[model samples]
Target chain A: MLVEIYLIAVVVALACSLPGVFLVLRGSTMLSDAITHTVLLGIVLAFFVVNDLNSPFLIVGATLVGVLTVWLIETLQHTKLLSNDSAIGIVFPLFFSIAIILITRYAGNVHLDADSVLMGELAFAPFRRMTLFGMDFGPKVLWSMLIILIINVLFITFFYKELKITTFDPGLAAALGFSPVFLHYALMTLVSLTAVGAYDSVGSILVVGFMVGPALTGYLLTHRLKRMILITLITAVFNSLVGVKAAFVLDTSIAGMIAVVTGITCLLAFLFSPSKGSIQAIRNRWKQRKNLKKQAASSHIKS
Target chain B: MEQLLALFSDYTFQIVALGTGFLGLLSGVVGTYATLRKESLLGDALSHAALPGIALAFLLIGKKDLVYLLGGALISGLIATALIQWISKKSTVKFDNALSVVLSSFFGLGLVLLTHIQGLENANQAGLEKFIYGQASSMLLSDVQLLLAVGAGILVLVLLLWKELKVFAFDPVFTQTLGFQTRILQFILSAMIILTVIFGLESVGVILMSALLIGPAVAARQWSDRLGVVLILAGLFGMVSGVAGTFISSIGRQIPTGPTIVLVLSLIVMISLIFSPKRGLIIRWVNQRRKKKAYIKQIEEKQERSEKYAR
Candidate 1:
């Protein structure tokens, strides 16, 4: 049972971190934050129409809302009235606020609450097992998260070059006949789909943590895109494992413990990484200064 | 009119509305500095980060006291801000990356602490979860008074350092060149923003507080380019949203105060975006069309003169 929970956590974290690398590189991590929140509104609206929480329509609705969020933010940004960040700040709250209001008002008797949306119950995930024709398929979350992970991997593999070029230099990508806008929306859709898939177990806030934390920790350790992606996956898996163990020991929220571990890992990398750590930079500067002094003394003696 | 009078007469309604209104006014005034500094989202992160502080304070003190909880929130929020600044500065991570990571991780830690508290055999823990979405109707007279006093103090600080803040907001480089302590000014402004978030936690909660901070300032910016005017307009917009949201929510069954306030504030932002006299999309569109018509008229007259000359 615990293994299933860990599996779900690890898979969800990996799935989120894939698009997160591009988001971190493209400097739009906040867009993921905004998308995560707005998808709740989509879920709620879809629930109103479908009257079912587990229906596939919820994911469809969330993805559509996620795309709509990006479109709205971009349109508002293009007006030049506000900065892109401000545009994001303005748009997401509107969607999220409406969602909350809907849940509190008409959906009072439903299996939805703002608390569960923010702090998901990961412990109960294993109990909700998947079964087909008297055969046990393990936890529902595991299968869903696995499907998301496979989709994410397939997407990254097929469009690796296009994603890389567009993320690094959209102008070059456009000049080379690749539509940056299309790729961007495609990435955002993937992010949203992954977010909704992961939403049931880790909730929205943890989803943001899973997406940004591992990618950033990887970024601190490597500069190469492939290396960064590999490191991100490793960090996600490592954090999820440690986080699960720690949460079990402490009897606390698994997602929160994972997030805390993510923070610590990023901090450790920031302080101790060989190439880009601050401590490493300080040591290099000191060594350079010492070498310069030695060279100056040698020159004086020769003179 | 009678219902409005009755609402004012009701003690609970009066306290909640007054407290939220003052909160809105205060955050609006202080949040301008944040938005101008491009740190609007920092408020979002700070509010979420403050949650663990409240839980920790409750654990240590074994009670749910407002002052100490807010103090704890302030301390943790400051720590989060410091971490964000340090991470972005020292690492290869950008500001947004640092922000999202710190924001979510801090919030996640808060959740862990909250759940731990929930498991403990204590009845006092029941009220702490209200900070997540907030229960404005539960506010007391003392809460309103604390809000008023702290809000006034912040307002006084804003006034005392108005010139420095304005300069810092518009151009930190210029502010430093003018012999001002840029770091101290930044600390002061950051403190002010954090204070606003803490006070607002009870009224608007963590999730919607960013909207309160960002909405009013963005809407105010649309109306005027002047900083002072924008501040005043933002305060007005925020106050109106708070009071109006409170009233509407009070009348409706199961309508929450925080989301209602945010929805109202977003309405103000949308209206300002589309309909403001200056910097509005509608107005800009109209002006462009008129200019195009005039230019076309001039071209036609020039064509007629050239044709007469050719004849």
Candidate 2:
């Protein structure tokens, strides 16, 4: 059961980190943060329609709302009325606030509490088994997160070129006859889907940690896109596994511990990565300055 | 009508309403500066990053005193702000990435601290979690006094530094060229933003507090181009939402004050976005259509004249 929990955490971290690479590359990490919050509105409204918290339709509803959030922000940005960040800042809270109001007022007696939406109930994942034909298929969270991970992997694998082009230079992508706008929405849909899938496990805000942290850790270590993705995947698995053990020892929130671990790994990479680490940069600068001083002294003595 | 009167007469309602209203006003006035400087999302980051501070404060003090918790939150918020600034300055990482990373990691640490406290089995820790979603309905008169005192101080500071802040927000390079200390001004503004976020966190919670800071300022910007007008309008809009949300939530069963206030503020934002005369979408659309029609009309008249001259 404990191993199953770790697997679920790993799956969630992987699922979040894949799209996170794109978000980091595109500089839209906060959009993931916004979508995580707004997806609650989608889930709540879907709950009202389906009247079932565990309904598969909740994911559909959430994906739609997430797309809508992106659309709204883009539209607002096009209007020149508000900047992208301001648009995001305004839209997400409106959605999240409404969702919270719904849960507190109408769905107060139900299981959709706001705390679970933020903190997530990862420890309880093992108890909710997915039984098929009376045969238990381990934890339900593991299966859902596995499927989301597969989808993220497929999306990135298939659109690697288009995504790469659009992220780095959308104008070039457009010149190559690829619709940057379409790809943008497609990536956002995938992000929303991943957020909803991981929503049950890592909650909302921590999803940002899982998504941005590992992707960034990878980014700090490498310049190549493929290598970055490879590094990010490794970082995700490493962080989640270590986080599970730490949580078991400390007996605290698994998601929180995972996020802490993610942050630590990213910090390590930032401080120590060979190419981009601050320490390496500082060392290089100092060595260069020393070389310059030596050259200047030699030139002066020869003169 | 009687229910409304009864609500007003109720002491808890009065305190919560007053506290939230002042908080709204404070966040609004400060938030305009944030939005102008394109730091609107910084409030969101700061609020989330404040969690660990609250948790650590509880662990050290071993109590649920609001003052200590907020103080802890302030210190942590400042630390988070400093870290974000440092990372952005010291690395090639984008500012947004740095903000999100710091925000979430700090929040994660906060959660860990909270769980640690919970594991300690302390008696006074029961209500510490309320800061997560906020329990404005449970606010005491003293909380309001504290909010008002600090809010007034910040407001006075803003007024005193109004000219310098205005120039700094619009153009920091220009502000520096004019012999003003832009770094000090930047620090002061960020501190004010952090203070506003901490005060609102008690009522608006971490998630929705950004809305309180951004919503009113965004809405008010739609109506006016002048900085002073935008600031005053945002403050008014925030106060209205605060009071109105408190009222609406009180009348409803199980309705939370934080989200309700946020919803009210969102409504104001939507209205301003669509209907404000100067920069509103609806107005812009209408003016564009009128211009298109006039252009077509002029072309048609010119064509008719050409045909008559040819004949």
Candidate 3:
């Protein structure tokens, strides 16, 4: 059971983390945050309309709301009424508050539990398995996550050149005839598609951590984009495993533990990366000072 | 309304206003440094970090004094900042990396402890939990006075050291070249932020205090280019929001004061961004329209003069 659950955790972690690399690089990290929280408002509204969590219409409506999250944030940014971060800060909190307000006001009418919707149990996920085509398959969540992961991989692979170009240098990409805006919208859509369930799996807090942590750790470990993606995926999987294993042993929340483990790994990378490691850089400075002092003393003797 | 007043009137409104005001004044003074350092986000992180401290304070003291709870919160907020700073300095992680590390970890740990604290099932626990969203309506006059002393002292200290802070924030390279201790200046500033946020956590709660710390400073920035003016305006804006938000929340029974204060702060930021004289959108539009007209006139005059030459 734990093994099945851990697999689901990995699938969700990868789905979040793969796009996270691009999200962080594009400085849309906060976008993941905005999408994650604002989607709750969507889920609540969808639930209010259909009153069912398992309905496919729920996801369809949620994705539309996710797009609105980006749209609202962009619109807010355009108004010059708030700075970029401030606009996001204002809009998401308002949306999130409204969702909470709705829940508090209509707790009985709503089937969407706010706390569970915010965070979910990966262990219990395995128990919700579905049989597809008469073969032994995992949970519907696992299948959905795998499908999203495939989309992310396909997008990353097929448009790898375009993505790298646009992300690294959008102006140049535009001048060279690629539509930055198109790429931007498409990427945002992908983020929304992946984030809804990704957020559902480990919760908003962990989804962000996964989205941010693996990619960030990879960034510190390497300068190249390809290596960064591969490393990010590996580290994300590792985090999910450790998190799931720890939760199993300690009887703690898998999502919370995963967030903690990923944070710890990022800290380790920060401390020990060869080129930019803080301690190594500081030590190098001290060594240079010691050599300079010796040279000064020796020159004084000669004089 | 008269009957309602007769039934509901008490010391709580005045006390809550005084508490929010004290918080407004203190954070406004200290947050200038937070903004200047480009570490405004730290306020958000630190406020969240105070949860563990609040829990620890409750456990260690086995008492429920506001001062003790806040003091413990202050220690934890400082710890969060210190760990973030030290980890960043000692490792390759960037500032955000250090920050996110402390933020979620501390917040998660706090949640875990809260699970235990929830089990306490006492009167203190009921009121104490209000710190999650803030229950400013419950503030005692004594708590407000304590906040006043702390806020006033910090305000005086900031006033005294205004020149030094100005020098440091505006041109750190220049200040360093001038033989000033940059690290010490940074330390002093961050210390003030930690202290301000500690007391602030009680009134505004943990999550929303960052809105208080950054919102006024951000709003004030759009109105002026001068550092001193920005600082003073920010402080005033903060005070205005604190007071107005408290009054509005008082009208409603269930609305939390902290979010109300932040909502008000956001409105002020909106106004400043759109309408301030120099940085605001209106000024830019007016300037651009004027420039475009002058350019069009220049082209017309050149075309007319060239036609006469051809004739």
Candidate 4:
């Protein structure tokens, strides 16, 4: 059961980190945050239709709402009324609050609640088994996340060039016949899908951590996109394993522990990464001061 | 009508309504500066950072005293803001990244501490979770008193430094050149903003408090460009939303007060977006249509003159 929990965490981290690199590079970390929250509305509306938390329709509904969230944000941004951050700060809460209100009013008798939406329980994931043909499979969350992870990996692999072009140089990509707008929506859809898949295990808030933290840590360590992606995966897996152990030891929310671990990992990279770390910069400043002192002493001796 | 009057006359409802109204007014005033400076999301980060502070305060005091909890939240929120500034300045990381790092980490810590406190068999821990979603209906008279004090302080400070703040917000370099201690002023303003966030957190929760901050300011911006009018309009909008949200939530037993306030604020924003006379979408669309018609009319008249000359 422990191993299964670990596996699910690892898979979730992988799924989020893949798209996270793009989001971080594009400077849309806040948008990812918005999508994660508004996807709750999609889940609730879908739950109302299907009346089951485990239905696949939830993911589909959530992905559409995620796209709508992006559209609304973009529409507000294009209005030149509110800044990008304010647009995001406005739209998600509206959608999320509506969802919370609905859940409190209509879904009171059901399993859906606001607490689980914010802080999902990963420890319980292991007990919710999936059975096929009267044979027991592993945890349902692990299977679902595995499938989503595969989708993310395949999507990233196939659209590697397009995503790279669009993320770095949208104008150039458009000039080269690739629609940056289409790519943006496509990426947003995938992000929505990832959020929906991970919602049951890690909840919405931690999804932002998983999506941004590892990718950012990797970014601090490396300059190349390929190397960044590799570092991000390593960091994600490391954070998840450490987080599981920490949560077990502390008897806290596993997702919260994971987010906290991801934060620490990013902080460590921020302070100590050899290429771009603050420590290196400080050391260089010290060395430069020493060189200045040595040169001044030599000049005095000559005089 | 009688029931409405009775609801307003009720002391508990009045406290909740007035407390939320003050929250709206304070957040609106501070949020104007934040929104104009493009630091709109700072409230989000600060509110989340306050969670750990609230939890830590509860742990240290071994009780759920509102004052100590709010003080702890204020200290942590200040730290989070400082860290955001420090990281953005000291490293190559951008401000948004730094903001997210501090927000998620602090919130994660808060969640961990909250869960730990919940397991401690302490009776005081029962209401700690209310800070997450915020139960304005559950607010005590003491909380309302705190809100009144903080709200007055915020209003007075904003009034006292109104000119300097306006100058500082519009152009910091100019403010510095004019021999102002721009850094001190910026620090004070940020502290006030953080205080406003902390004040609203008990009513709006950490997640939706940013909306309260941004929503009214955004709505006011649509109606006016002047800073003073915008501030006044924002305060008014916020107050209206606060009262309406409180009243509406009171109507429905299960309606969450925080989100209800947020939704009310959102509704105001939507209304302003479409109907506000100055910068509204519909108004702009109508102006564009009129301009197009005039341009076409001028072109037709010019064509008639050319044809008459040719004949």
Candidate 5:
């Protein structure tokens, strides 16, 4: 059970971290945060329509709403009324608060509660079985997340060049016949799908954590995009394993523990990354100072 | 109408309404500078950061006293802001990334501590969870008193330092050239923001507190460009939303006051965005359409004159 949980967590982390690299590089971490929260409304609305949480319609609805959120924010941005941050700050809370109110008033009797939405229960994931034609999958969440992970991997692999071009130089990419706008929405759809898949196990907050934390850490450690991706994957898997173990010992929320670990990992990289770490910079400065002092003393002695 | 009047007249409703109104007003005033500074999300970060402070205070003091909890929150919020400032300053990381790091880590710690508190066999721990989404209905008179005092203090401070703060907020280099202690003023302004966030936590919760901070300011910005007018309008908008949300939530058994207030604030923003005089979307659209029509008309007139001359 523990191994299954750990694998599921790693897959979820990988799924979030993949798009997260683009998001962080594009400086859209806050947009991911917005999508994570607003996607709740999508999930709840989908539940109302399908009358089941397991329906794939949930992912479709969430992706639509996620795209809508981006569109609304972009529209607001075009108006030149509010800054991008304010627009994000405004839209997500409106959608999220409405979702919360709906859940409390209308869905109180249902299993869709705010607590699980905020602090998802990973421990309970193992007990929920997915049966497909008399075959038992260990956990339903695991299979769903695996599917999402595969989709994310395939999407990234197929469109690697396009995504890279669009992400780094949208104007150039457009000039080269790739539609940056289309690619942007495609990436957002994948982000929303990944968020919804991870929602049941790690919740929204950890989804943001997984998205930004490893990506930022990877960013600090490397300059190359490919190397950053590799570093992010390693960081994500390592953080998940450590987080699960810490949660087991502390008997706390595994999702929260994972987020906390990811944060710590990022901080460590921020402080100690060989290329860009503050501590490294400081040490180099100290060394430079010492060398200057020695040169001054030696020159004085010669005089 | 009578029932509505009676609801307003009720003591508990009056307290909740007054407290939230003051909270809204305070956050509005402070949030203006925050929003203009592009630190609109700072309130979100600080509020989430305050969670661990509240939890730590309870654990250390072995009680859930409001004052002590708020004190702890204030301390932690300041630390979080300071860390954000430091990380952004000392490292190559941008401000947004630093904000994200502090926000998530602190919030994650808060969650872990909250779960730990829950595991402990203490009935008082039940009330602690309310801070997450806020239980405005559970507010007592004493809490209202604390809010009033803090709110008034912040208002007075802002009033006294209005010139310095304005200069600093608009242009720190100019303020420094004027020999103003910009760093001190910046610290004080951050302190005020942190205080407003802590005071609001009991009502707005950690999750939606930033909306209360940013919503009214954004709404007010649509109407006016002047700082004074924007601040005043933001305060008025916030007060209206706060009072109205309180009344509406009081009317229903299931409606949550915090989210209701946020919804009301968002509604105000939407209305202001659409209908405000200067920068409203509708007005802008109208102006564009008129300009296009006039341009086309001028072209047609020129064409007619050219044809007539040729004939």
Candidate 6:
């Protein structure tokens, strides 16, 4: 059972980390953070209308709202009235607050568990079963996670050139006949989609870890975007597996434990990665200082 | 109208009003630095880190004294911040990760202690938990007085170090070369940030306190380029949000103050994001349109001039 859980976790982590790589590179980290918060409104609103948290319409509604959040923030950012980060900071929290308000006003009248929006249930994920065409399949969590992974893979592959060009040099990309704006929105939509769907299993705090941690750890390992994406996928999968099993053994909060473990992995990568690791960066500086000191000493001795 | 007037006359609303007002002021002033540094998450992290310090202070001192507990919280938050710094320095961990580790550990420790206290069924624990979400309605006049004093002290410190802080923020290397004690100044500023978090944690609860610190500054940044004005404006935004949230919660029986304040503060930030003069999105769109029009006009005139010359 534990082995199955770990396998599922690996798949889940890899899928979420795919879009995270691009989101981090485009400097839309905060948008992803904002989307994670705003999804509560989407989920609860969908629940209010559909009366079922388990319905697939919840994912659709959340994704659509998440896309709207990205669009609104982009529109706001273009105005130059506020910086991009501040615009995101403003939009998502207000949406989240409204969601919280709706919950308080309408609690117990509906089954929209507001607390579940904060800390998702990763351990109990294996229990939620899915049904296909006349056969009782495995968990719904696994199926939804698989569906997101497929979408992420397809999108990343199809728009690989557009995304790469847009991320690196929007001006050059525009000159070369690609609309950076289109690609930017596309990327954000995918991020929000994946994040909103993924959070149902991983929770808000751990979603960020999956988003940034793997990409960051991969960044330490390589500079090339392709390699970074691949490595980030691996790192995220490993992190999720480690975090879930550790939580099971430790008997603590799964989401919080995953976040802490992600932090630890990032720390490890920051320290020991061959090039530009924190310790390596510091060592080079020290070596440069020592060389300078030696040159000064040699000149003095000669004199 | 008479009953509303009586509410104003009562002591509870007065105390609640004053305490939140002081918190609003401190949050606005300190939040400017957080937004500028782009470490807004630090606001959230530090608040959680202060939780255990409050519980520990109560445990050791056997008193629920706000000042004493706040001091303990301040010290512990600083230590957590320091530990995050040290770990980032000495090890390979990234800044965000270090923050994550410290925040969770401290919060988890606090949770354990709190649940233990709850199990003990101690009478003192009775309203102590209220600090987490902040029940400003339950505050006394003494609490209000302490808040005002702390708020005043923080404001003075911000004024005293305004020049140094600005230089450090914009260009630290230049400031260092110009003979400023960058480390001490930074340490002091960072300490002030933790203090701000600790102070707001009492009324906003540790989890919700970051909204107070980060929200107004974000809104203020949209409206102005001058750091000083931005700081002041952020403070004003905080004051408005604080008062508004408190008022709504007081009038509405079931609404919690912290979430209401955060929601209200968040609304101001959104308004600034889209509508604030030069930085606003609508104005930028207009500017781009105008610039494109001017460029087209210039091109047309130049072509006409060339045609005349040819003739």
Summarize candidate 2's per-residue lDDT along B191-246 as a digit string, tens digits: 99999998888887888888898898999999998998999999999999999999
Can you give the lDDT of residue B119 in candidate 5? 92
Question: What are the per-residue Cα lDDT tens digits for candidate 6 across A211-245?
Answer: 77677778678889999988888788777777777
Displacement of residue A298 (Cα, Å) in model 5 is 12
TM-score (all chains, Cα) for each model: 0.97, 0.97, 0.85, 0.96, 0.95, 0.82
lDDT of 4 by residue, A120-235 (tens): 88988888899999999999988888888899899999999999999999999999999999989999998999998888799888788899899999999999999999999999
What's every prediction's RMSD, in angstroms?
A: 1.6, 1.8, 3.9, 2.3, 2.3, 4.4
In the range B28-110, model 5's lDDT, one tens digit per residue, is 89999888878888888898899889999999988989999999999999999998898888876777777776787788888
The window of 10 residues in a row where model 4 chain B has the poorest summed lDDT is B93-102
DockQ of 1: 0.84
Model 4, residue A203: distance off in Å is 1.4
- Candidate 3 chain B minimal-lDDT segment of 10 residues: B3-12
In angstroms, give how far residue A120 of model 3 lies from its true place: 4.7
The TM-score obtained for chain B by all candidates, in the order given, is: 0.96, 0.97, 0.90, 0.95, 0.96, 0.91
Residue-by-residue lDDT tens digits, candidate 2, A5-95: 8889989999999999999999899998999999999999999999999899999999999999999888888888887899999889888
The alpha-carbon deviation from the true structure for residue B22 of candidate 6, after best TM-score superposition, in angstroms, is 1.8
Instruction: Go through the candidates in order and give each one's C-alpha lDDT.
Output: 0.91, 0.90, 0.75, 0.90, 0.88, 0.75
Residues A1-303, model 5: lDDT tens digits = 989989888888888899988888887787888898888999889989999977899888987898899999899888889987898888888888898998889898889987787668788888889988999978988888888889988999999999999989999999999999999999999998899888888877668888888999998999999999999999999999999899899998788888899989998998889989989989999999999999999999999
Candidate 1 structure quality by residue, lDDT tens digits, B288-311: 999999999999999999999999
Clash-forming residue pairs, model 3: A270-B92
Per-residue lDDT tens digits for candidate 6, residues B1-311, read 88778877777777787678778878888888877766666777787778778878888877788888888788878888887787656654456555654665566445445545655646777666665556667777887777787778878988898898899877878999999998887788788788877777777775567778778898888888899899989999999898888878887876767778888888787678668787676787789999999999999999999999999
Docking class of 3: acceptable
Q: What is the lDDT of residue B239 in candidate 4?
A: 91
lDDT of 1 at B247: 91
Residue ranges of candidate 4 with Cα displaced over 4 Å: A284-303, B298-311
Quote the positional error of residue B184 for candidate 1 in Å.
Answer: 0.7
Task: Quote the lDDT for A129 in model 4.
Answer: 92
Candidate 2 — which pairs collide? none
